[model samples]
Target: MKFLWTLFILMALMHTSSAQQTQKPVLHGKNWMAITGKPLAATAGAMIFQKGGNAVDAACAMLAATCTMWDMLSWGGETQALIYNPKTKKVIAINALGIAPTGATVAFFKNKGYNFPPEYGPLAAVTPGTPGGLCYMLANYGTLSLEQVLAPALQLAAGYPIEAQTANSIERNKDQIKQWPYSKKVFLTHPGENREAPDAGEIFVQKNLLQTLTKMVETERAAMKAGKSRKEAIMAAYDRFYKGDIAREFVRGCQEQGGLITMEDLARWKPLEEAPLKVAYKGIDVYKLQQWTQGPAMLQALNILENFDLKSMGYNSARYIHTIYQAMNLAFADRDFYYGDPYFKPQEPIKGLLSKEYAKQRASIIQFDQNNPRIGPGDPYPFEGKANPYTALLKKRGYEMDTTKRNFAPVHDIRNTSSLIEYQQRLWLGTTSVEAADKEGWVVSITPSGGWVPACIAGNTGVGMSQRMQSFVLDSTLSPFNVVQPGKRPRVTLTPSLALKDGKPFLSFAVQGGDTQDQNLLQFFLNIVEFGMNVQQATEAANINSNQLWLSLGGTKNDDRKPRPGQLLLNNNTPETVRNELKKMGYTLSFGDRTSGPINAIYFDWKHGSFWGGSSNYGEDYGIGW
Candidate 1:
């Protein structure tokens, strides 16, 4: 009877613990705080600030520890960072994007019978940038050496309890993982026979990754003994992967498998640091990564919306949400058309795209009565002094060019039957973000991606290369962002955000959804700036649909692969009447779920000498200030 009672108690405890994972996170501190997708990593970052490390050091440590989460980020992945230095009053964009190999030409894939690189495998892979990025942060901006910054990640890689989400990722990809012996050895319980992912709450240990990191640590130590400076010693560790053994193995893997990467590519590849693409919005200056990623999509959306009274549109009302989605679609269309690797197209198109006049033209295209059948790219070329042809088209429809609008009274019946099939909500999360602000007025935000678990492992180096090459478009008809070429980093999707007010740091934020990164962050910002929600309220708010559209090749049942128009994902909180009204506008609407934007945000209220932090469903995220 005593044994039975003990078992009953254990069961009760297990149930209680499982319930906590679903609860919203609540954490705030004053004096150096770190918040990330994982709890341990957040704490690890906080620990660094307490140890007298700067925001860059805390963020570097946090990013390193974040590599343990294979579902979100990997040790060998692509990474981008935005650092704000108060003294210099400047923001730096780190383009730690993995580059296509010297041999990754369009002909190579055309000969392989693929329209593009296969979504999986070494051919889709690029040289990872995560390690080199972390080391770059250490050598340039950080106060701690790589030996010190790498400690938390090394500790976690040695042994840490696996969360349920991570275990599920391992199990779902177990079949693909087992085919690669090195991957089978690292992520599963045992090779082949016990190949399933470990049960959740299991103590997961990755000795292989630990060994790889320890070798770098050893290199750092050796350099220190050889009389290297702190930064030089840290870079010695960094060189272990870029110019050393790991780079050789990575190149060898591609060579053996007939993939394109080479050691020379790795050796010459350095993370690019440049000034941010700054855009002025509502008196606040917003900064984002350059043209390489989709960061500009957010800026373009804000610029277009600035023409309208977004505050007047009741927050989250059907009309308000529709306006936002319409603006998003317009921005995405521009992104597909104009954005690309600035290195290839040295003349970035931002000068024309972000201009207030350009935005006025785009905003004028939004029709509120009925959803646009499809919104594609617009010509942002110099709009002659004469009104744009779009303005003329609206005037022909008896609409004015100014904000005092008329005629949104339903041109076509939305309830009219159009053969449209609904899509299931997506569950793809292949990247992670981290941010930190020290009491000393330094801020950092980074989005690290590329090294997903079911990816290339670089010939036993345990370095997972990115399939980010999939983001490239083979044809340049839409934009030069297309047209793959050797020695070019494909246009990427890792967008991080930083905001400044009155020349002072005001916000540091990021979200993790490939094409949806800009979509979600744009909405979250509106939720705070326009809707007046606090940090936590803004985070837990629902995202509009991410897979709500596809390009419309031909609008019929036969054209499902192309863009589907007027789809919205809403939950119960959205009134039934709103759904009916949207449907009446001819939209293909779905319910029961919304997009997952497991986001975290930190606010730098320097004026008040405090910070506000909030995140969606929590495992290890917090916002603290000191």
Candidate 2:
């Protein structure tokens, strides 16, 4: 009788836990679905869809709207996307991430006594990429004209009611905004008033930005008048932004503010469309961008986790958490060292890093009893039939052996450490995601970032300069692949994902968080495939985050950006038993009510021939489906 009672209670507890995953209802649609960081931005995508646009056109509109709204990014920001084309039956990557301008070499920064590039202002700027990226995507895959696609963003540039999140951000960072003359003129509406930033719900206007966008549209219209093809017309607009008067003003503004961008830098840079990398996990194939971004870290993690029976361990179980955390750290360690620009360098051993044998070799070092604070990058060259040239450097840097005495500071100094962690969280917190899908089998997943608020506006263009230069490292000892160089792209945290099953689109997903992007994405993917959760549930479901890898953003000093291994973030509602077990395994735990980050995704419901959209309740992420 006692055994029966205990079994009943266990079942009841499991049911209750499962019920919590449905905090938000699953969004269903038959024709199309558009989801992004803000409701207004999603509405922009929907407007395009309602006007007979496909997923690509809608996605470009959403990207423009988000950039105009300063949804954690701006016009000068970079964009990274993965698009699943139904006609071609292939997933293509958009490498619109900005490159370092001339004079942005490691020596240039090292001469300033800096560990990494500066975090903000014109000095931290990279050449803008989003404008050309949107134009390229629209011209190649979209059916609409450039002017038609940019209507919503042009309206936004004219004026819109600013949200409190953005208004307050400007107010909080007003001191820094004042450092740049153009930014001061555009952001500080009240000038000498105590509250210079626009108040929440106030109509915010950018005349200069509106004019700049108008110039692009006008160029497109003029090109059409000249009997140019649609693609040629769009390319004309791209030229105006890069090599024309807009570029001249942007360069003038950038250089006027102690920036390094030259006219040649803007004229030379162009977005690339390349084949994406993929790895098969179970029966499903997951695709990510090249090694330039951290997208492959998730692929590596999935390959490693494939060796274990994760479903058998149950969701959020202490053992499951430890396994996921370990696999993520292992993958990220490789990312910190090996992932960078493919166009530069001796090249990354990507073939070996994504190999099943390499995954198994990395997985073999995992110890189930306690966290491995000294987890480091693995040697992948052997699997690709090449010698490991960095073996000596790895050993010299103390990453070849386990020498960590403690992963957490002593209890007496916990408060000071907490303050630094809070700052680190802010640094790792930016970017917004876009996910859109249509009944025609077109899927788009984009993680666009850089040029966040308090941004330094480059000249009279009213476009914020990219702060992406900070993502580059000055010392080759840290990441030989990611060392700063003129015209080279930095390894970034923005990653978008796509998955296919049985030769069809299965899922398109992305999230807004720095280093935590892939960590949340990996668990979200598992929540659906392994745990049988609906799209919405998978997005909102509680997941753990591991801070055992190097910081990818915001630190002026090397020590400030060092990894804090064994530090784990768990949902506050985690069972006491699970918490105790994790504690026993040497995890220094932190709790949050929401830890999944803001994940936006679209799942193609093949059986029903519909679309399922998921927008996490963690932030302002929203979706519109019809």
Candidate 3:
């Protein structure tokens, strides 16, 4: 009897352990703040927190570290952040988006008698804005010294192990890196050796970048000692990067390389402090980056969703996916047609594009059984649009009409009965498309084009400048409209996002794909806001129907591979049983790997007083915290 009792106890204990292992890890602390990015980046933020810094200090530390660890989105680039000051209970948006160079008007290219190249040209680059933005944030909110915030990054640059993600990103951009001697030297092994990843503990150093950071630190410190106030000191730091010796050398490099940027342009660059875009959903208030990116469109999506009974629609069901896709189609149509920097054009008419009244009318247009016969922009606003009343109200007040009425061409249509049959036959064949979306509601669609060339030519303080112009589209249809105008920021697809629950900030999410920003964001939102899953679980979910091609490809019926006008891609997560049911309902389908971009999120649990952060495992990256 004693032996039997002991055996039963052991069995019970084993079962409990198994259950715990499968459950999501729960981390809690009131004063605890977490930064999710590369491990080294997180470590940098953790250092700040340990030293009595707040969230802003930690964020600055992490940003600097990422500049060294993930050069793709670092200094000499652009960064937009949505800071929620728990103390003040107020949220502020920091817009660091670069503007068009002084001499870079669309007519300049036309006068030069040169067509824009699909990748890398004079038109692809924007003024680097990260430095100015960082300076502003530090001066206004940070407690730690600039040297303290920069120490981790400088140390990492001096010598640190190259993480797997960094190695992979380097390998992917090898062709571009080869174009610049400095980049090749730092990123690759000697002459012709293939780029290699440093072993976990291997020390990797970027001597040039370290020197650059050191210079900035010294200049800023000297300015402070010279009796400059915090703001002046910060501005001085910016001057060191954009107008001092660094600026001179960069301009010289640009002139030597035939790039368009000048010292004046660099000196004139300034970060904007605009009101954040906000929306209310399910009693929670959500905010986004602004009109410069797809930040406002996300609120538009949520507003339309509010009109539907998503919980009853069943998660990932054809009906749920289709409804969400239609909403995105309408929102994106407006984004491409009307959204741009308001400072440049006073009559651009993008305000109220996603108003509730607008969403209700748009939601009414989605068909339950048949896919939309065509895809295009909805009706224009009834009145002359202005930038006031906020993006959320705009979503509620915007007009809704037949999208096909606009000149926008349709990419897919579900009206083709034959395409549906073919897709169904290949139901087992896999299709994939990887995408990324963030909670900050700032989407970046970086294309490799001419705008990025200056970065490579100038060599930003030893760190390679961004070569992100590869994401620009060269389709003749968009050519007439694609000119560099003064004060007009380039169109970007990098869309970071925020999700709200019960009228409060719920989650911050972002993905990393040039044109795949919105596509990835839509699917991820469905997984959580609709499907009811944790952050990690939602991130790991499959990608089936992307917002970009869903409408033209026949809703959620077409195979993701060779997506036709009315077909939709379905991944393994759709379930065999449910998939067959959809096929019987005349939907075309194909199987594929769940292709999604790397997603990073920090979820707030107000009820529990804790925060959870996670990075996508699908990518070679990890999220860490203390």
RMSD of each: 10.0, 2.9, 9.0
Stronger candidate by lDDT (1 vs 3):
1
lDDT of 3: 0.56
Q: What digit string (tens of lDDT, one per residue) describes model 1 on residues 405-515? A: 111111121222221111121122567778788777888999888767675566767667777776665545434554577777877778899999899887788877666
- Candidate 3 has a TM-score of 0.77
Per-candidate TM equals 0.86, 0.95, 0.77
Per-residue C-alpha lDDT of model 3 across residues 1-626, encoded as one tens digit per residue = 99999999999999666533412343333454444445666677667778876666667777777666653454656666666654455667777767666666545654654343123322345667767777777777666678888889889988987765456545655676666655566666545665443444557777777877888888879988999876677668778888888888666655554566678878888877766787777766767767666667767778878998888987677777677667776676666545556565434444556578777777788777755635544544643353342345335533333322221112222232235323222111111111111222211111111122113535545544433332222222221122346555655555556555654567766665443456666667667766766776666666654334322111111122111234456665566777766655445555545454555566676777666664555444344444
1 versus 3: better TM-score goes to:
1
Model 3 is weakest, by summed lDDT over 10 consecutive residues, at 427-436
Question: How high is the lDDT of residue 264 in model 3?
Answer: 81
Candidate-wise lDDT, in order = 0.72, 0.90, 0.56
For candidate 2, the lDDT comes to 0.90
lDDT over C-alpha atoms for residue 75 of model 3: 60
